[model samples]
Target: MNSLYAMPGNEAFAELLSLHTGYQRRQLLLHHFPDSETLVRMAPPTPGGDAVIVCTLDRPDPKALPLMMAAATARELGAARVGLVAPYLAYMRQDKRFHPGEAISAKIFADWLGHTFDWLVTVDPHLHRYATLAEVYPNAAHVVHVASQLAVWIDAHVTMPLIVGPDQESAQWVTAVSNLLCAPSVVAHKERHGDRDVEILLPEMDKWRDHTPVLVDDIIASGETMVQTLRCLHARTSLPPVCVAVHGVFAEGALEGLLAEGAGLVVTSNSVITDTTQIDISKPVAEAMVSLCEANPTETARRTPA
Candidate 1:
């Protein structure tokens, strides 16, 4: 008898997840004050059931306090356990302190979330530095990979897709999607001139010139890499390339920018609610949420050593 709660802006995905998990969907009523305080109100949780909060932490700064308050409210309402289903987790880019006096926000954020939720679930958190979520999160945490889902979208939408990675950082997941789709792939080298400027050096892709290029990446924040990649592809083929990604963190006209650069189609997982989110990842996330709610975190911690 797990109860699902949807935070603000996450109701649609939460409802889908509830349908998959067969859990009753609830809502957390939030009242914001002018002084920047929040009051979270939710119905009492079932006596022996887990209270799961579905909040996608994409733009995490404003949502952090409310999420903490919602979890605490659930616990105060006599829930047996509390968990979070954040489809797109943020604050994972800074996994290490690159310079002196820098704050490793990744670990700090993970620790804060670990303290708040008994169990956690997310989709494809930026695991560049930390090998796994377990390294930073202290409780049972699950990562829902969206590579197969990405492949499904690309295979169904694109014709004769030639999977392309924007840069070396994206090679791993891009390769996974390419292999899953059994499409030829190429990785490009990227030189960052500035925050929104990048130079893409693609290998000789004349062999794949005939096939429709499908540029793939995990997070499309600034979208400079994809834009640069599209520019490079312009020389190879006249056909408009398709762009697919897991999270579409379209920062200020990023989507329009890609379309303006000659992307035939842009698609992403529903990890973030945007018009380009054609792929629904709620089922896998629901499965992980159910598993996390059922398993005992203490036993899981014992089995997996520090």
Candidate 2:
């Protein structure tokens, strides 16, 4: 019998998931009204069979309601288990209460997801404050590392490259990507004046002027970090740097701004579907969900801390 069906914006990933785990691909029928409300019409999983809902939560508030409905309906119709594959998980940044009235948004969001789904799988969530996904999520959570795929992309596209990070926060991520590429890495010093205002100081790269600079980041929201990096690089190297990010959430014309700042080519993994998402992580996500399904059906062990 056929296995799971993927949601909209996830058709490509469904095809790759099938290739990885032999799970059949089908669609979840959905639509938006003139007033911007969502509707879901999809076949539930067969009795004793499972379902996987693939939804990328980039612009999350609008997407969450329908996704929750889909999961609930699948179970109402007799699904044995339901799993969520959200590659670009949102609202994961605010781990603590910065202000007095602020909500522990990440923990609250995790509660909603934990109570709704039996298992979860995602890629490179903002983990600066949290140690692991399990800490935020109350169930089986899998995080897909994008460095391997990113390294492959660099090898195939960039020549004589120097991997670089825009600030100290990106040191671990940049080092991981550089190690995979077997390329030298640099982490520039940066001070955040405000959310969008940042000052950067780059190291002297006069000796490696021949190499192309490849700026690697986990997420790009305002693109200021990259713009500053490109500005510093222009004085030392003649070539435009190839920019790569795991999550390309180009808010406020980040894509155009990067190109305007002399970025050679901007690219990212399929974590967040953007014009620059050129790499795929379907195999790792599929493997994670399938393993959860194969684990003892009790669902108790999945709640254990990772």
Evaluate model 2: give its TM-score.
0.93
Candidate 2 residue lDDT tens string, 1-306: 335666777778777878888876656888888998888878757677677888888878878889898988887878777778888888898899988999988999998888778888898898768988888898877888878888888999998899989998788778998898889889999988987899999987788788999998888889999999998888888778999998988887888999999998999888878899898877777778788777776853435321
- Candidate 1 clashing pairs? none
User: Which candidate comes out best when scored by TM-score?
Assistant: 1
What tens digits encode model 1's per-residue C-alpha lDDT throughout 167-224? 9999988889989989999999999878898999999888877899999999888888
lDDT for model 1 comes to 0.88
Task: Name the best candidate (by lDDT).
Answer: 1
TM values, all candidates: 0.95, 0.93
Backbone clash count for every predicted candidate, in the order shown = 0, 0
**Per-model RMSD to reference:** 2.5, 2.5
